[model samples]
Target: MKKVLILALLLISTVSFAQTISGKAYYQSKTTVDTDQFGGGEMSEEMKKQIMERMKSFLEKTYILTFSGSESIYKEQEKLEAGSGFGGMGAMMGSFSAGAQYKNLKTNQILEEREFFGKKFLINDTITNLEWEVGKESKQIGQYLAIKATAVKKIDPNDFEMARPRGRRGERGRNRDAEEDSEKVADTTQTESEDPFDQIEIPKQVIVTAWFTPQIPVANGPGEYAGLPGLILELNVERTTILCSKITLNTKETESIEAPNKGEEVTRAEYNKIIKEKMEEMREQFRGRGGRGGGRGRFGGF
Candidate 1:
């Protein structure tokens, strides 16, 4: 009996010391445009069809997420695009210069690193910031323990908009006039705010709720997300849910976990300038097209 008791205690200790977690992340999101912009008129059937087709193309692209503990990689196909084709066409008309492929537009990003309170955690680093939250509810995810947690995530619309190239530049005076006109239109469309959240457009704010399990004992999750008290076994954002599809623990570990060095090496200001220039170039191409009445938009063939 004593030997059996010692064996059980050893097993418990071993389980407590183990570290690692793995999972699959599923996500869903919709993209919509303001109908009041451009030519303010009722949308035609042809316009609606074009917008839907564009949205579908945008969502199908994939994104990559990496972190210190684990990485989540997947793709989101285009879902819906409402409003008029004029605005959509104006937005993308500038891609002619960069050889921009519509397929290259990524609506999502792969899980990268999560920084919390100045501490950095990395995959393959072995030492991670993940810790299990005690006394939390758990749900069975396959053979793993899934704990629940919520986080209110705020994203800047400009960040998302900049992901895709903007089309051509208008004449100096014309551009300023257009800008002023757009602001006026935006002011008129503002809805009365009942709640602080309602003041912002629905696409602008997103709340991310996640489920994790101490089974991995590392407070890590996919993308640049972390700081929960456990390894995130599942995450739900918008209407999509990412669950732990698979896990490998106490196996032969290979390779070291490190931070990823991707994306353009530019400051925020510089990046903005580049985007503006590209948009201007696109605008020039649009004007050269001899108006929108011609055969499809710039991307019609592709």
Candidate 2:
């Protein structure tokens, strides 16, 4: 009986030690798009190059994941800004992008802060348990020995980040006034026109490949990814690849791990619906501008 009690005490101590461990991991994320499909094959190679160069600022990014054994916060790294003519557009896009995400493995919960235009939304949802198929492949990423794992995840159709330019604009466009209230945003009928933003397409599903190291012993990673046996050092989903560039473990100074409290609270489903309605509104606005000779059809005035 005493031996069994001692064993139980050791297990408890191990768990406590694991929970006390904390660190920050920095990742570089990059996404690529096919320039040939930008404008129905009408754009010159030079034009495509220029567009890609302009998009490089938005496509390539750096993120930081501050994590413990059971909790984590992932957010994009802030950088010094240079003067630009598109500052307003940049600010709008920044809000549209995913905000800080907090995950708690013990509670199986995720809290995400999102901003649409000028409104803020706090998404409170459960963490999706991805069933990863671990493979025999092993590789060295930085100083960590990582193993291969893959999973198939359903793509969120409303995700603008995953959009890829198709061949041409669609024949129909939806025109609606953008609503400030989430409840007022509804799926409604549309009018017909040549909508340039319709050229972008998002797939239904994607295969995700991840590399994780057991040395970290944490079931957390950057973005909305988790449920692994270790910290994910690399992730590849669709056209984006996130690679961890550096890791600082068990620092002398630790950050407080807590969920964001700002913004109107909503479920994941509610947030998706809200974003969809707003995107439809923007599409119509661009379509109208294009019809009036003020719109650059390729990438909505890029």
Candidate 3:
């Protein structure tokens, strides 16, 4: 009877521990932009400085990740305003910002809430697990002893984050004298003139360096990062680096881990297609209004 009682108590304790396991991690995310890559035509150094100042808020942001053992929700913390003098440029940059992202390790599902130019979309997709190679390297992140891991993360070829401004616009007006002589020439001219994304080469993959702590014992991290042995404390992806600033585990107050259900449901491919189309339209509008400014806006410019 004593042995049976001990086994029952152990089972009960395990259940209790699993039920109450939840955590909140605060991360400060920052991305560096090279202003030198954004010089439009005759833009002066002072103009570049002013542009960097305007982009400061977008380059740096705070995010909160609330997670349970199997699920997590990551979103940017609310702020009163992005920054002072954030005009049209802010709105343009904000279009690339992602909304709340929900991840379910148990279900192998990833859902993201994205808004592009006032159109809300719920991207429902299966999580593509990355094969992380754990290393012997270790470091201290706050009070946690984190282990280093690296992975090669595939990115979209048209990823705006990695885009750089072109030195000049693509040459257009092919077969100009012929005018309506051939439909092929008109189509080629439009393609060369309107699609600015063709100018810059965006990398297809980037090296991801992550530091995770087994002390947390949760396969979760900020943004679309996971599949680690523990919660990720620091992540370095190209120009962006996200570091966990604070972590609260097993608190009396547990935030709900509900997946975001709002917005029009769309697959990841559909969403990317929509964004590409809208981006082209926005680029044309910018060009029509500001001429060479649109070329600068392709990557980090206004």
Candidate 4:
């Protein structure tokens, strides 16, 4: 009888511990400028329209993510450009150039795609870094216990450089100068002097923060993020924030979680190689124009 009682108690404990809770997540993120300049340089109306159009194009891209032990599904919307330029005509121009209706307005989109156990969901980029901490526990979010957490992450300043692509002209000129100096030194048998700007590296950084709930017991959060005790239902990274506006628990149905088949996953070094190759391809495409500023008119009077 004692053994039977012990076995029953163990079973009860297991069942109690296996209980799953569901809830929404909320987070606050603060953005910091790491570059010397806070915003991009002045651009003409046409140039701005063109840039906005490209941004809208990027908004069309999408991905999927999934989680374990939960029936509630989450989806992330793509980022779209917002705001008007000069007047209604400028706004109309922006809308027509981007091929999108004003109804679809998204500022930023998530970049990471995740899959688990045959199901896929999009990662929310709104959450930068997800961390957990002990605090005054609350039972506001369903049967789940909740605690507040915070995390900070830096944004890549090179994103602006890539978007502008103007500094490359200066870099190409320096390369030409170095080549000329090499030729001169070889012809005259004189040592060549180092270029003053050759060793300088540009500084860039942006910081973001987030809050998380650890009751769900999974270390997965959102985007290229993990390491939390529960699934991240909300995120606030950069100027964007995603809140778990709704959630549903187990019903009469079951859903499988699966890993997403992201094509051509590569290491950091491999990605860099791809970027370098693409940049070279672009340079070659516009070679005769003068390399970076080869065709000034193409940049649209920036």
Please report the candidate that would top TM-score against the real structure: 2
User: On a 0 to 1 TM-score scale, where does candidate 2 land against the true structure?
Assistant: 0.76
lDDT of 1: 0.40
Q: What is the C-alpha lDDT of each candidate?
A: 0.40, 0.69, 0.70, 0.35
TM-score of each candidate structure, all chains considered together: 0.43, 0.76, 0.73, 0.42
- Candidate 3's displacement at residue 30, Å, is 0.6
RMSD of each: 13.6, 10.2, 10.7, 14.6
Candidate 1 on 191-274: residue-level lDDT in tens? Answer: 221111112232444557678765565444544455554556666665345555555453344224333433334433444345
Task: Find the 10 residues in a row with the least total lDDT in model 2.
Answer: 182-191
The C-alpha stretches of model 2 lying farther than 4 A from their native spots are 1-17, 79-95, 167-194, 251-254, 286-290, 293-302
Task: Give me the runs in candidate 3 sitting further than 4 Å from their true place.
Answer: 1-20, 40-46, 79-91, 158-201, 251-255, 284-302
Q: Which ten residues in a row have the lowest lDDT in candidate 3?
A: 164-173
**Candidate 4: where is the Cα deviation over 4 Å?**
1-65, 70-148, 152-206, 214-217, 251-254, 291-302
lDDT of 2 by residue, 3-91 (tens): 44643454355445558678999999988775644444467998878766666766788999998767889988964331122322333
